[model samples]
Target: MSDNVYIAVHGGAGFHERKYEKEIKHALQRACNVALSNLGSKHSSALTMVEDAISSLEDDEHLNAGYGSNLTLDGTVECDAAIMSGKSGCFGSVGAVAGVKNPIRLARAVLDHSSIPSPIGRIPPLTLVSEGARQFALSQPSSAHLVSRESLVSPQAEERWRVWKCRFASSDPSSLSGNLNDIQDTVGAVAWHESDGMAAGVSSGGLLLKYPGRIGEAAVFGAGCWAQEASDVEQGMEMACSISGTGEYIIRAMLARRLGEAFEKGAGNSDGDDPHEVLHGVLNDQFWNMRRGRGEPDPSVGVLLLTRENDGRARLWCAFTTPTMAIAYVSSKNPKAKAIILRRPQNITLGDDKPCIYITGISL
Candidate 1:
């Protein structure tokens, strides 16, 4: 086993309310602890840790992912999830899926299914959607993961949906403005293990009142999550990233994979190999600027990234354009997970030419 193993998770990049701060932090810390607890098992790897951690997050009703996800236009619960392995470059996802207790487990099953040799030379699917995804889940050995669609909906989510749906029908422009506390904050995780290198995964309940069958970045390859090793071992860094924000903009930019590429290419500007600069450059040039040019006044995104250098140093980085982002981290060296709700300072003025982005790094 590798001497160092680490896992980090994010609740989402959105306006996390001060009233629910304790519950949000506890949820993130619980996931970190659940992931790290498997360290004693001989079979544990980065992939499993990522899966385990996200499954825990999905079960929580407070965040928007699994059980307490947002409702569709017709008031049905649908979810999107994806997982990727840096070691093998394997990817799997499910989109607009319902009736699954844990969507991340289904995604991992898809990744595992892709490895089987096919006798008829038929290509396996990287993603499955709607009823097809549910059928595929039923075909898996653990059919117990499937549940009644209504059973997955929490009382709190149903109430939120009812209130929003009424407001939506009234044709109130304020409805379109959206409540900060009720935004679609997709949850995700990134991890690195001595033996398996790195892996990342993301899950989302999607936007409230969205049309049925709508898919978000969480279901798209290279958009929601990315994990990869450095091509040039001596000079480069192995990295994995999980992203949360507006799905359309994130999908167009392929934000997660873009960040991985930036790290692999080294800092191209005068910043001189600073990861912080690379993050700012990508968020500004690729995401923020592009969105603004297209007439988008506000674009939200939050990223949780894990990096390991050739010299055996590892760090966790969080960057977001939203008001606040909740995250937690734990490693073998420090078993106790630390959770924090990072809020952008209100005193910081946003300029017309500048993107409202905050970046911070934590040593693991």
Candidate 2:
């Protein structure tokens, strides 16, 4: 392996309570460690590291993915997940699926299946949903195995669902906000390897009391995750990004893919290559402003991005419009991963039409 291997993960972008801070940070750190643990294997690549890291996040009850995901209106755990490869431009997704142990694994399976030549002249599916997704899981390896739907629901999630469901039945407009403290939107990972270039993946349980068959940004192409290698690598950057936030707004914005395009076109400031400026511009013009213009006062979203410059320097960038976003990063040179819960300044004022976004860069 060439020394460019690295992975970063996010524990969602929303209101994270201080009480669960330790658990959330530990979960993100564990995911980074999990991704790096298999680096010694000869076949490890960015795709596998992204998968393993997200699988670790999915297993953590502190996250809103495979296990402990938000419950649907019917009190069932339905999930959305997707994975993409920058080198090959291969993409796969599963939407509103239940009974799967690791939704990201199933999404990876979908991606792998797309590579197989069809017996006939038929097109393969880029996404699978509901029962079709579960059926597809059955055909994959044991890693994508299915379990009881109830087994995926944690006690805490169930209690949250019970309370939320009661509030929903009351039809109280004030209760629409639910419990922001317990809201964890999505979990995702972005990775880069010398051999495979870059890859990104995302998984989510979706919003509390969401419709039974609702699919979130995690299951949509170019919305939840995007990874791409520049055509002119000698003068360009390879990038991968995973997003978490309000699924509807995110899906409409196509935030991940748009960011990749912005990086490619150098659409930042007058210098035209500042990643930080690009992030702020996109969040302001494309996301926050659009939502506010539509009469939505608040728009929540977070992006975890990995970029490798032509000179082989890798950096991690995180930008969010929410109260907090949890992230962790580790590289082969720095095997010890660092996890941080990035919180916007409490005193940061939100103007009537101005964007309230925070952007940070970390050297890898």
Candidate 3:
């Protein structure tokens, strides 16, 4: 209800060794700047802003989305993407899609194409996977081909594929699917525009050498992203969230929707628990540990929450269970964007050199 546009993005939530921090930081900053620049202009809506932001990440080989996407065990590239519009609850997604450059744009195109009425009382499918998804993209009314399959395979990704294929051949096949220690997870964005409402989008190459046809949380509606407009902040509808981490844990735990519900319930509680506490408790104590009994290392979860307050203000909250999560954000009220390579969330404070990325500024 406020005339403010907010944008936030995450490169991933995973093991980022010290060696890759500088490049990761630059990627986060670049993505944030692109999103903010679009959000600042009157022409851009939240949907387009997020689409553009994720596209930028896809282009950057440092992060996983399009170009840097992980390869499958069979040495092929398949990607998944989804986009949602909070106003209508209308969404579209493509999974295990190969060829198209920006899968996020294809996801948006699906959403847009579905909104048009068909004379024969038919509605387009909300989600498409595998070869079917690729056919759909090719069928769209466009003169030039939107993407080529070979173009999707970047040199970096191809090299990763060659090396991972050798590793897959020698390693135990049973232990390969869930391990993401080597390759980073998904990338995503959640945003709000005063004129265009709220939107969220997520994209991923999926875990490296994962089983073919495996669909992660990013392709699922409630697990990967969600948004709602709140006329009254006290009543709890003013939140949007996007996530990047182990797809399995996020899907099993229902991270995005559950986080939104937590924010809603926390709004009416008299207890003074902060947003960070609520987020960390849900992510670490509930979700991360949920699968620990299976004798596997606790998978990390990274999240971004965008809330519009009662007093015409917007706030962004980011949290992750990994050693570091790459994130960046900017709001209409604060034009100077800040990028954080998050390390320890529990010990973060306002004055620390590596302070938390949480920000609340007066909205336009």
The backbone clash count of each candidate, in order, is 0, 0, 0
Candidate 1 at 143: error in angstroms?
5.9
Over 1-364, each residue of candidate 1 has an lDDT whose tens digit, in order, gives 3447999999999998899899999999999988987776778899989999999999999999999998888999899999999999999999999999889989998988999989999898999999999999889884329889998788988988888888888978676565733477799999999888999999999998889999999999999999998767767778999999999899999998898888877733345257788889899999999999999988899999888878878899999999899999999998899999999888998679799999999999
lDDT of 3 by residue, 259-346 (tens): 7677666775642125666676676555755666555565667787776666656667777666677778876667566676766645
Model 1 segments more than 4 A misplaced: 1-3, 142-144, 175-182, 267-272
Model 1: how far residue 259 lies from native, Å:
1.1
Per-prediction TM-score: 0.96, 0.96, 0.84
Clashes of 1: 0
**Superposition-based RMSD of candidate 3 using all C-alpha atoms, in angstroms:** 5.2
Q: What are the Cα lDDT values of the candidates? A: 0.89, 0.89, 0.73
Error of 3 at 311 (Å): 1.3
Candidate 1, residue 146: how far the Cα is off, in Å: 0.6
RMSD to the true structure for each prediction, in A, is 1.9, 1.9, 5.2
Descending-lDDT candidate ranking? 1, 2, 3
